[model samples]
Target: MTQRQPRRAYDEQGREIPPPTLADLRAEGDRTAFVHCDATGCGHEATISTDQFPAEMPFPDIALPLRCAACGSKEVGVMRDVVGIYARPRERTGWGMT
Candidate 1:
């Protein structure tokens, strides 16, 4: 028989709400990445695929298009660097501290 592990939860502050399991991570279409705006007070959430965004582009720091979903403005500017699989911490280190 196999033992089932408990799921983990996290708060907005990144505090561990609970311990997560392999299944938990696999939920929601294998959710692997998260995205948010760089602007202050803007707490938008966007999910991206690990395969689509190669692990080469700087993630959590890449300069992607910044358009407001609420207002729909093209005049939008890069509020903050976006986050993704390509922007993983290891990738950043591999660049040899740019």
Candidate 2:
């Protein structure tokens, strides 16, 4: 089997930085395994399939947390409430008014 290399975080200079180990990645994955929001202090919970992930993708072991790709913040959350039409009695028209 081929030896897997850890992913590195780089500075503005583009120099090589310390990479995350498989164990580290796994730990992170565990933390966010069920999370689906981008909130401060929130861990990443979703995972991408290895086949779909790029070979050089960082943090291979740890699933990528839901974040704002443009802003790189975990402050993003999935929209769960959706508006839909439903048939109701006229007397109940004001049920969802609030």
Candidate 3:
């Protein structure tokens, strides 16, 4: 027999939200986000995975205090992928062109 995963917890709106864990992060299809150094003229975007942090540590909060590798800046900005590139239409043709 095979074992089944436990159902995720939910709030008033019935959103299935599970605790931030290493297993969960790894299972979430290469979950990635964009980050950059807050220093002026150092806007280099870096793609980091959620699994990079400690399993027990929560997101955003965990990555907030991280420093930039390129500029060695203490301030950093993180961007969550609301609409992933892979999820978008592959063939995108604008109205003006063909």
Candidate 4:
């Protein structure tokens, strides 16, 4: 199968919404969203970075236009990404220390 490239999604208002990428989202402090297949027997999941999708649209509405890429099913579940209250500690390499 050919690799699927990210496609520019559009909002109902005809605005071009850029597809989410983890790096871009993290740099801009944007919230990430997840899309999972809700099909009874389908086990598919994907993570996407987003913030107020399609021109600042809200939840449920933002999820409305999404379709499952795995099973080609419209029965999918969407939710915001969750992060733990505490982040992992980084090692003290002391490389940049003067």
Q: Can you give the TM-score per candidate against the true fold?
A: 0.28, 0.23, 0.50, 0.49
Checking candidate 4 for backbone clashes, the offending pairs are none
Q: Model 1: per-residue lDDT, tens digit, 1-98? A: 33332223456775655533324433422335454544566655555443444344433322244455654443323222234333546654476323
Q: After superposition, how far is residue 25 of candidate 1 from its true place, in Å?
A: 14
lDDT of 3 by residue, 6-94 (tens): 32356677665664554455455537666777799898778777656765654445456678999888778665544453564545533
Off by over 4 Å in 1: 1-31, 61-98
- Model 4 RMSD in Å is 12.9
Local distance difference test, each candidate: 0.41, 0.39, 0.60, 0.57
Global Cα RMSD, each model: 16.0, 16.9, 10.5, 12.9
Per-residue CA lDDT of model 4 for 15-77, tens digit only, reads 666655544545544456767888889968887655446544544344567788888888777
Clashes of each: 7, 5, 0, 0
Candidate 2: C-alpha lDDT: 0.39
- The TM-score of predicted model 1 comes to 0.28
Rate residue 72 of model 4 by lDDT.
83
lDDT: worst 10-residue window of model 2: 78-87
How accurate locally is residue 10 in candidate 3, as Cα lDDT from 0 to 100?
62
Query: Model 2, range 4-92, lDDT digits (tens) per residue?
Result: 34334456776666655434544433212222434565544342233333434344333454455444665543221122122234365
Position 49, candidate 1: lDDT? 46
lDDT-based ranking: 3, 4, 1, 2
**Candidate 4, residue 71: how far the Cα is off, in Å:** 0.3
Residue pairs that clash (backbone atoms under 3 angstroms), model 1: 7-19, 8-18, 8-19, 8-20, 38-80, 59-87, 60-83
Question: Native-vs-model 4 lDDT?
Answer: 0.57
Q: Which 10 residues in a row give candidate 1 its minimum summed lDDT?
A: 76-85
